[model samples]
Target: MNKDQQPVVLGKIGASHGVNGWMKITTYTDSVTGIFDYSPWLLNERGQWREVKVLRWRQQGKGVIASLESVDSREQAQILTNCEIGVLQESMQNLPEGDFYWRDLIGCEVTNTNGYNMGKVDQILETGSNDVLMVKANVKDAFGKRERMIPLVMEQFIKNVDLLEKQILVDWDPDF
Candidate 1:
């Protein structure tokens, strides 16, 4: 898929691990090694996208180190530092029932039980207790508040998430 079509960011290339072209990776997946599930990663370099194959990889201390096929030196690995590694949306595995990826929640409109439009999800933050949804206020709800942070607690706060409709129904107080 093209760069614009790529959906999920699996990981990012961090500092070079060693002189032999291995680069430290900071993954956004559930597990550190889960990033390796998809091959032929698309690296976002500047504004262009380049495909790179993972020659080999292994888990390190809480993270992962990988060697790309063409990257065979410390200097080569350095050039890829801070580059985002992503795969096409179709490459992701299907989730089980009641589970959802963070990417799927972003940009979805959030409304209250009374059918009042609250805002659109701008980002999702992971807290010690639970996940928080940061919703950017819409024109209708832009009453001095610019954003809202709602807890993603199923049945408690989050009533329903309709990804197909690009909306999330919540049990929130718009005044709060």
Candidate 2:
């Protein structure tokens, strides 16, 4: 698939591990090893996405180290440092009921029970307690404020998530 068609970023390459082209990877998934499930990662390079094959990988401490084809030297692996690793959207695994990927939630409009449009989801942040949704405040509410942080506490603050409608119904206070 094309670069524009690339799916969610699963991980990012870190510093070089050793002299054998091994590089450390920080994954965004629940499990670091989960990233390996998606083969043929797309590496963002100079504004363009290039496909890279994962020759082998292993879990190290809390992160993972991998060897990618064509990268045979420590210098070559260093070139991939901080590069985003992604897969085609279609290659992602199917989720069960009540489960949603962060990619699907972003860009969805957020509204309250009283029909107050909070904003659109700009991004999601992970906290030790729970995940928070950073909603980019709409023009109507952009009076000095840029965004609002809403906790993703299901059935409490989040009422419903309608992917088809590209909206999230919440029960948050408008004043806050």
Candidate 3:
């Protein structure tokens, strides 16, 4: 698929709610109802992406249940169980400067302010208090570690982030 048409995974389809093809949803959005903001969801069916229209949805207690325009039977809903939901990457809203999405941070080169090549970012960790960058180091680096978890606190540790360059500069200790 074209890069612009690629869908960004956003949620997962849980078990069928009732006999009317309504299914529970587990979303990755900051707000539960925010998932509804993006319509015509690109649902992954057996690894293939198909667009599904949202008929209606509601919040029950703490969970969300939604019905698709075409799915009107329990069997149809059952077929979608465990399927992931996605939306076009372009559909996501623009984030302000200095706020990078986790997906964009993956594979970015990391360096300390002293020009030490720490490694490339492998993933991010959300530890409630702060988000962390999990950097994977070179196999034979003279440094003592394979992975480093640097907090994403901009005011202190993070010195600069150049998304265009795919690099992150931090005020970190190389030998730590």
Candidate 4:
């Protein structure tokens, strides 16, 4: 996506909560309440993205139910079910040092310490102990590896990450 593009989805609108027009919400942030931090959410309604404010919200059991401004009826709330809730991408909070967002690492080149160009990071998997980088390798590699699962363990596997250079240095064996 273009860096200047807005509308990074933080959550999705679920079914209407009550007759009072409250709607169930599912957030995609670190905490269930994190999505609420960015209010006046941009909701994708039909083909258009409409801005709506969170007038009130409460956590009920494991899920969240909310009431939005200008939506005061169950029918109005039902119309929003399944629509995405987004905020401008530029509005995302910053992270500390050594931290990288998944989006930034998706296209990074992976290279072993032996100087073998492993591949580009295709995806990241959150395992029980730590994260793993799924590297899609070149078809002509000596090991015939189509993909490699490199643990994102700093010092153990990952040596360095250069975001500006778009490359990852690893302590991996190319023939493995």
Candidate achieving the largest TM-score: 2
| Candidate 2 TM-score versus the reference | 0.93
TM-score against native, each model? 0.92, 0.93, 0.90, 0.79
C-alpha lDDT score of every prediction, in listed order:
0.89, 0.90, 0.88, 0.88
Worst 10 residues of 2 by lDDT: 138-147
* Tens-digit lDDT string for candidate 4 (1-176): 24456687889999998799999999877688889888568998885787888999999899899999989999999999999999877678878998887767888999988899999999988886998999999878789999999999988899999999999999998776
- Candidate 2 lDDT, 1-176, residue by residue in tens: 75358557998999999899999999999877999999679998876788899999998998889999999999999988999998888889999987899999999999999998888999999998999999999877834457889999999999999998999999987668
Residue runs of model 1 more than 4 Å from their true location after superposition = 140-143
Clashing pairs in 3: none
Higher-scoring candidate on lDDT, 1 or 4: 1
Tens digits of per-residue lDDT for model 3 on 74-112? 999999999999998778889998787788889999999
TM-score ranking of the models: 2, 1, 3, 4
Report the Cα RMSD per candidate: 1.6, 1.7, 1.9, 3.0
Clash pairs (backbone) in predicted model 2:
none
- Error in Å for residue 45 of model 3: 1.1
